[model samples]
Target: MDRKEQKSIIEGLLFVSGDEGIYPEQIAKVLEIEGNEVINILEEMQKECEGAHRGLQIVQYAKVYRFATKKEHASYYQKLIDIPTAASLSQAALETLAIVAYRQPITRTEMEEIRGVKTDKALQTLVSHLLIKEMGRAEGPGRPILYGTTKEFLDTFGLKTLDDLPALSEENEQMNEADLFFGSLQEISK
Candidate 1:
């Protein structure tokens, strides 16, 4: 097929796939094109979304990709949408969540050690929010319940996996930015 036709075909496939990102190899096999060509097309499409000409952006996380909105339109988009924005968690919960997210499969005592505070209330709040869960039991004395972030956390953050979270150095800022960016894109898609 001609390049123009190929582009159209690729766009159609991407749209059909929607949030379930297609791998380059899969696109290549389906379209009878080189994997490199598929990569190029995907990159070009992503650039179009991120470029000044388009209102959307593309991001890849854990090998999965999604079309998101540009950060510049955050405020106006917020006014245009009816998204849930009033949930507030206590500082203790936030602290506990951070610990659990980074140090998953950790025991309650380990969490308390990191925060230097009792985690009963924080753990309860996190569990209620469905962000943190008791993954299982530790393999040691007393066999305490291991804590970890849930799949809900991944969906809420628009992540394909835990690896999508960047390195721990700028975790808070990176996480906040990702939430704002993906959250806004979700609103726009709706």
Candidate 2:
């Protein structure tokens, strides 16, 4: 591929890699290009993002390349986070929260398994909104974080306690766990 196409592909790779970032060698392998060429392209992309108009910058941590917000925009980003809104939970975030509400001390991997999609962004949203907090670490490999609902979640939903949550219908054995959780959430909201 051409230089411009390579840059675009690399940018996409970095975006999809998220917090895990991407190694230059991995990018080289994927694009079928030389490692040195990948580095040169990454450096060029990094420089391009350094422009004043760009809100994101390419950062390399421990040889892993990823896109991160510019440090100079921290105040603006903080303001955005601090600002309150009447926005309701997104479907993904709401579903993730419901799963956590019923399944306390759940790990992100477990949530993803239930939802059949990646839960990282939704988990981050719930954590940022203070609806869920890391309860502890699960016992096993990686010691994955266990998430549970916070007090704010209870107050927001106007529940006295976890027991206040509606019980799933035993008659609907065909209903998946996520659907059952969503049903309970709807009943709670009403």
Candidate 3:
């Protein structure tokens, strides 16, 4: 409705978007406003976040907007990180990890196609757990990030190396990749 309302809505969108973040064009499309106006509002909001010394701040990276904790709170956050916690992986995260493990350099879009749903939260969890990482960027448009399993994956799975992974039967290999991914997830969850 008004500039304040627009800025507040944009903040909420960025907060909910998490690490994936949102683009100005996406905000403009949703708000039915000009892209230039969205850009100007976002810039002003960014300044307000910085000047206010609020615990939360807006970050723009790769043209994506996200809400993040201020850098000044890093020490406190690090203290919390140092605490021990046993976090269990969600089924979706396990499935995404399995796909990344077998596919070895898959993109998020490809993973989503296999999962038949958006995999952003699962992907972020895998990344946070250090089971999957950005191996590189793809060759095509936007150069989407390519994900791959890491050494932590090997250690967590108690495998000596990727070669230690069980081989799929010829018939199974021919089955849908999503099935293979789910099969792997079941095996690991055991």
Candidate 4:
């Protein structure tokens, strides 16, 4: 494809790669371009992201490229996170949090599998809100991050412990898992 198209594809690939990042060689393979070309394009994209108007920047860590927030705007980001709101939890965030609560130390992939959709954004939201945290890395290839509910999560839900969460019955298994999880939280919200 053309240079512009290549850059756009690279951006999407990097975004989809999430926190794992992507290697230049992988980008090259996917775009059917040379590694040197990928590096050049990445460098250009990195520069563009560094512009004052851009809130994101491309970061290279150990040869893996990924998008990250501009450190210069840390205060603004902190402010955004620190602001308290009466907004209820999003459906996706609630579902993801429920999965994490019921299934502590679960991998993102497993959560996505259970939800039948990607959970990256939901996971990020939960993490930013301090409702969930990265417990550790799971054992196996790639060593994906394992997530679990935080103390704040218990406090927010007014639960003394995870055991205090409503039990999921086998009959409920026939219903959508998200609905089951959401229903329990709705009661607490009232």
Candidate 5:
């Protein structure tokens, strides 16, 4: 395929890969092209995306490329997130989000322990919504996936930083941590 055609194919692959991203070698292998050629096309594609003033742009991280909204259009995207007519969080998803937001870098097992229910569905919902994502793997035998809120979470909730999260009440000795978690969720859900 010609360079232009190759660029188009690579762009489509990146879009399909989404947040997971795609490596140049992966593209080259799939397309039956030289790795260096794929890299060159990606470089050219990146320049065109920025120069064309497109709403979306290609970005590379850790030698992997993904398509993402341009930073300049954050406010426009934030407007859409603020008015999420398409998707609303179920009660379970909200509770899962609350736990992850407050006690981030936490494992699924830890959340399940606190909630006293399996969080598989709720965690999947949060991840699919881009509200929460894998922060990293936890230490120990199982090496469970740790979860944390995303930048989209901050933008959607109007938080300047994690510190902007509503403070948990320390004065009420009777108030449990779950109460605090739900309290934060209510604020963000608004």
Candidate 6:
């Protein structure tokens, strides 16, 4: 396949495959090309993602070639996404994030059960914003990654640690007061 066509196929397969880190063979099958050809195209793509030309990184250490924001360029994404600050969460994201914070090492399926909605978007947003991360795989059938808040989560909220999060109760306040919410911009926002 042509380079343009191969690049298109790679992006589609990677995005659709989610964080699962799809294999080159899987991408090759989708593109109807020899697996070696897929590998070659991926090599070219990886080079393009390197150094000064990069806003994207083609990562592979986790056993898949998924596109990701280059670490140095991360400060620009809040602008590109048109959010007022570094990142903003939907209410659903906040709710699920709360659950994950209080009950960490939690699975997506378990979070879904608590929130009663498919958490794909919220989880994606949370992960993209670096508020939560994949702790590790569960010991269940799917072996899904457990989710938990990160050090950035603590810093963003001006907390010394996760234990600094405010107490919760049986009451559900519409506008809860907690360390979780902060001013729209902070230390790295400039």
Using TM-score as the measure, what is the rank order of every candidate, best first? 5, 4, 2, 3, 6, 1
TM-scores for candidates 1 onward, in order: 0.46, 0.51, 0.49, 0.52, 0.53, 0.46
Candidate 2 TM-score over all chains jointly? 0.51
Error of 3 at 182 (Å): 8.3
What is candidate 6's CA lDDT for residue 32? 87
Overall local distance difference test of candidate 1: 0.76
Better of 4 and 6 by TM-score: 4
lDDT of each residue in 1-190, candidate 4, tens digit only: 7889999999999999999999999999999989999999999999888789998899999999999998889999999899998766788888888889888889999999888999999998999999999999999999999999999998988889988887889888667666776687788778
| Model 6 per-residue lDDT at 52 | 96
Which of the two candidates, 1 or 3, achieves a greater TM-score against the reference?
3
lDDT of 2 by residue, 1-190 (tens): 7999999999999999999999999999999999999999999999999999999999999999999999999999999999998766888998898889977889999999888999999988889999999999999999999999999998987888989876766785546655676677687677
Candidate 1 local lDDT, 1-190, one digit each (tens): 8877877787777667788866778779989989888778878878767667777666666766556667898897988786765767887777677678768889999988877779998899889889988889989789999999999987876768887764545545545433443454467457
lDDT of each: 0.76, 0.90, 0.86, 0.90, 0.86, 0.77
Q: Write the per-residue lDDT of candidate 5 for residues 21-99, one digit (tens) a residue.
A: 9999999998998899888888888888887569888899999999988988999989988984778888888878878
- Residue 131's C-alpha lDDT in candidate 4? 95
Q: What's model 1's TM-score?
A: 0.46
Better of 2 and 4 by TM-score: 4
In Å, residue 32's CA in model 5 sits off its true spot by 22
Candidate 3 lDDT over residue span 1-190, tens digit each: 9888998889888988999999999999999999989989988988888875588888889999888899889999999999878788888887788778778899999999887899999999999999899999999999999999999988887778887776677888766554675566469769
lDDT value, candidate 3, whole model: 0.86
> Which 10 consecutive positions of candidate 6 have the poorest summed lDDT?
176-185
- Superposition error at 79 for model 4 (Å): 19
The backbone clash count of each candidate, in order, is 0, 0, 0, 0, 0, 0
Model 1 deviation from the true structure expressed as Cα RMSD, one decimal place: 13.5
* Candidate closer to the true structure by TM-score (higher is better), 1 or 6: 6
lDDT of 4 at 162: 86
